[model samples]
Target chain A: MQKQVEIIKANGEREFFDEGKLRASLLRAGAEDSQVEAVLRHISKELEDGMTTDHIYRHAFSVLKDVQNPRAIRRYSLRRALIDLGPTGFPFERFLAKLFASQGFEVKNDQILQGRCVPHEVDLVAYNENKLVMVESKFHNRMGEKSDVKVALYVKARFDDLSEQLFDYGKARPLDEGWLVTNTKFTENAIKFGVCAGLKMVGWNYPEKGSMRDLIEDSRLHPVTCLPSLTKEERELLLNNDMVLCSQILDSQSKLIELGIKREKVTTIAAEAEALCGR
Target chain B: MQKQVEIIKANGEREFFDEGKLRASLLRAGAEDSQVEAVLRHISKELEDGMTTDHIYRHAFSVLKDVQNPRAIRRYSLRRALIDLGPTGFPFERFLAKLFASQGFEVKNDQILQGRCVPHEVDLVAYNENKLVMVESKFHNRMGEKSDVKVALYVKARFDDLSEQLFDYGKARPLDEGWLVTNTKFTENAIKFGVCAGLKMVGWNYPEKGSMRDLIEDSRLHPVTCLPSLTKEERELLLNNDMVLCSQILDSQSKLIELGIKREKVTTIAAEAEALCGR
Candidate 1:
């Protein structure tokens, strides 16, 4: 076997290089199995000692760009798309709520509930008849600021605070689970504790199979901010109205013109949104 | 004019006292003109330079307790009733929500919202077709701990954050007003700042006439904890079930039995509740 290599993380943490993990991420971005393998092998041999993961990602992104269309490239940048959703990240939380709402979960944004020790403000709560899920959105304006294990731990503690109230109060069955969501990636230990603690988590690419990126792609409820057809001002229009998904634009297609998007361009915006949401 | 006598506040701040405000309070508490006048004249004669408001309040509470009934006394101890309603003040927030709900406003509690400067957690949001109201409940376990002017300042800043979004989105008209509610009292500066800033406030006795105490009395929503007939455990049962208003118990009178109050005592509890809510 070749000598094991180490990669530095965005937060200056170091870990052993894992080719399998990198390959999985690329495949999730719509790379074919053959393409993912080939790119990982090529990138592996070219990797420098103590290379940061950002360099590795950039190298891969550049290679992927050559093979993918602008649209594919756009979807592949789901991580950046989410980060671009907001300067405040409230828009991103709205986007996540829409995704759950699409899945038949009733959602409330920004629920402040009493925790055992002190008052806790939760980012979102989604529920149906059987399950309640609390979401804590750790939004860092900068993409590199990952939601670490510390975030997961604190969320679990907060969830613990209200878990009892769920059963005792009106129609509050115990929460199905607490979800720690982030626009960026999670630290490895965050995944470790969360998996062990059974706190559901979603982030850029934490869980190998059903990560945040994978979930968005599978759901087709991409944040409206991700639509290439929209300008920053138009995106702001959607955001200010708490419209998160491209699908929302499709549902209220007429809202485009009402939003000062020109009458003729409404069709263009709708077509783009329909294509992005895969409807 | 009694030379605008000064009273030392709980926080050791001294401010000029107004007797008109005091008389209005006593009259609102259901005291007759002759009684209120007599007490004011008597209490005014004894007013010393720098008497803390706490001492003055005790004197008033004792005097008022004499004229009020056992049930009225229970209702009058709004501060203790609120504290007794909670291991956490979730019940008080629920009570405030119910107060609005009864007024034909749709209510949601613990609404997490993004403010301009940061994320703000509002206690309740009540709205209807014509207007929206955001409520921030300041619950203190101790009676002397008041919601100060600093709270009003911060809440005003948070309201500025989402005020614009209301007009832009889903059935949201701009909030008609933002209300700061407390189980206890407001500092003089808090009332002044809130009034000047156009932030409406309801506290134990801040607004004198239609104060939080008066609201509960007029709405007939006495805290379940205020019932002297029930034991601590039964009160806990009521609090655990989100039962704050005495009116709620009258609707589900059988619940008193379900909660382990004696079957015979069920009628007793019901009568007390009905009389308190005037149902």
Candidate 2:
């Protein structure tokens, strides 16, 4: 019998290390099976009792950087990049709008929708012929900050208020769904409340099938911050110009030229963005 | 017409000074009309454009300390004293339970009640023959921190959940009402949402009637921390021992003795507490 190794999580909780969870995260980042096995082998050699998940992530990231394509390496850094889209949180909302847009929904960011009692400035409102969804984005710049039950509860109430009133998008209709999206995880009670209240929620890694990560990957709407070719300031500038996704950069070549990027540097960035999104 | 004097509020917004508001606050502290006039006169003499409300409060508090009874002085310091009860926030909950109990309600603190879908650990639940109310206390240690719409929304949801299940509190009954109480103020939107959602809310100075301040004053449930006789540590010790109300200390002399107070000092403390509560 093998002894289970203990590891410290980012939120200061200690739990037994799970090899399957690590392998799954690696595989989700599009790492090849052979590369994942090598990474796992190296991780097992370095694993010790009371090691932090941060330490594990850094080790895995370094291994992936060495063995994988820039695309996969960028994908591996998705969580960190999502967090890096913050400090203002506007970019994350724009990113969400784009994510929904990619799924055949006409999205509007920061719309003032009239509720039954008061006006609510919803973060993103996405609608199609079939459904209208109101999303509230809870963006936390710091790690380990989970969207709690209060956020879920308030979002439910806000959506309920809006559901009582009809709004004209393509035609006059009530809100079909309310969604709570965050760049972090949701607390257990928050998830429970969301389920009981019949509100849709998407966090960084919640709900087995379709989380924020799954949706982002499925939509291929990678944030520009994930591009290794651009510096931090360059990425922020693009975000400030409302170009959040990698696809937006491909569409807006003039934004880079306006940001004073040389033609050759622009080509490199465009190529990196294209490769990162596998476009 | 004379230009209105601009005053900076605690939350950093500038507004024209209203002497009537200041006068009402002084009167609420049980200040006599003559004493109130004197305070107002002094305040007016020293008033400057762009003076913070904090400065006005200090001026009023200083005057009240000079001319008012110990009870009035304590009431004048009530808001600050409430904020002082925190950093841990348990004392505030205990204080609230006592406040409700003083009104002939059977109050329990930190009870895990079964909701429709999950169990919720409510802060204070107060029940009488006619009414059962669940309270969620938002205790902020910092000034200018208000219990916002999110809090009211969650409390309403939580209470609604509990409303689905009957509780054995004297008799089997569902929750009759949900109240959101704060030691501070409520944001405008929070108040609107609370009203729209049918959630009863009590803040330090809200509703124009029957607020937390009104209830505290009417009940004379002055917290032990408001007693000028006790040192900060001694007050904390009482709070730690669950002797939140000054009336509790009056009922339990042994607690002071256990806290290592001398006989004469105990007499002084008791007398001060008694005078502070006018009991």
The whole-model lDDT of each prediction reads: 0.70, 0.79
Superposition TM-score, candidate 2 onto the true structure? 0.74
Alpha-carbon shift of residue A164 in model 2 (angstroms): 1.6
Model 1 Cα shift for residue A103 (angstroms)? 1.7
Model 1 residue A42 CA deviation in Å: 33
Candidate 2: Cα lDDT at B89: 79
Model 1 chain A worst lDDT window (10 residues): A263-272
DockQ of 1: 0.02
TM-score winner among the candidates? 2
True contacts kept of 1: 0.00
Report the error of model 2 at residue B79, Å.
1.2
Tens digit per residue, CA lDDT, model 1, B1-279: 465678876446788766775566555445677777666766777788887665564465346445546355555555577877666778889888888888888888877665432344678988887778889888888878888755765566456555665542238467778888988888886776677657889998769788888777777777776554566787778878877877777788667666767654454455445434444
- Candidate 2, residue B260: CA error in Å? 3.2
lDDT of candidate 1 over A40-68, digit per residue (tens): 76787788779877567657645654555
Best by DockQ: 2
* Stretches of model 1 off by over 4 angstroms after superposition: A1-72, A167-170, B1-279
Q: How well is candidate 2 docked (DockQ)?
A: 0.36
Report per-candidate TM-score of chain A alone: 0.70, 0.73
